[model samples]
Target: MNAAATTHHHTSCLRCGRKLTSTKSVATGYGPTCTRKVKAAAKAEVVAQYKPHQVAKAEELIEQGGLIPLRGQIYLAVSSDGSQTYKTHRAACSCPAGIKGLHPCKHRIAAHILSLAA
Candidate 1:
């Protein structure tokens, strides 16, 4: 192939507008430093939306493999009792607390955490 045909044109970074040359950076649209900052900011936003206890529980659920990805943003969260599974999404969950709409449930929080990690 000719040099011009083989040459990869660098894309602008999504966060900083710097030219991205690395394959991973080009694919993700962010350079290494900007990628870290973007991910940290996203995680912080997710954490800020939930209570400390809820975030703790979500982390525990993730560590224990209690949250299983079903498809897309949907997940199957095993109940603490291990007797039931609830369909969960970042914004919605099938758990009782979620159904009642009192507040964001632990299952929902877990989904958000998992999404951010991905």
Candidate 2:
């Protein structure tokens, strides 16, 4: 057992912050799984963006089957009142609650859930 060979640098992946398992991962600054996610997210497409709390709400909505994914960035949200609200990222909503800006609405939350699922 050579003492000089015992040391290792616990480098973390830049994307997922997981411990880099390979010398290549440490050099590249990303793990394999996170590298794929980062590349997919970097594509010229609408990625469902969400804050931490919004993701939490989206998780619940997804479990309840209240979120439906439409084409592209569009999604349909089934509200508690049984009315359907269309949520397009940064677009209008049919529901009275409305969806706009950075505010988190049920429809918007559902759309986010759909985005993550797709």
Best by TM-score: 1
lDDT by residue (tens digit), candidate 2, 81-100: 44444454435455566633
lDDT of 1 by residue, 70-115 (tens): 6887987778776677899989989899899889888888777656
Q: State the weakest 10-residue window (summed lDDT) of model 1.
A: 1-10
Q: State in Å the error of residue 51, model 1.
A: 1.3
Cα lDDT for residue 32, model 2?
69
Per-residue lDDT of 59 in model 1: 63
After superposition, candidate 1 runs with Cα above 4 Å error = 1-43
Query: TM-score of each candidate?
Result: 0.62, 0.41
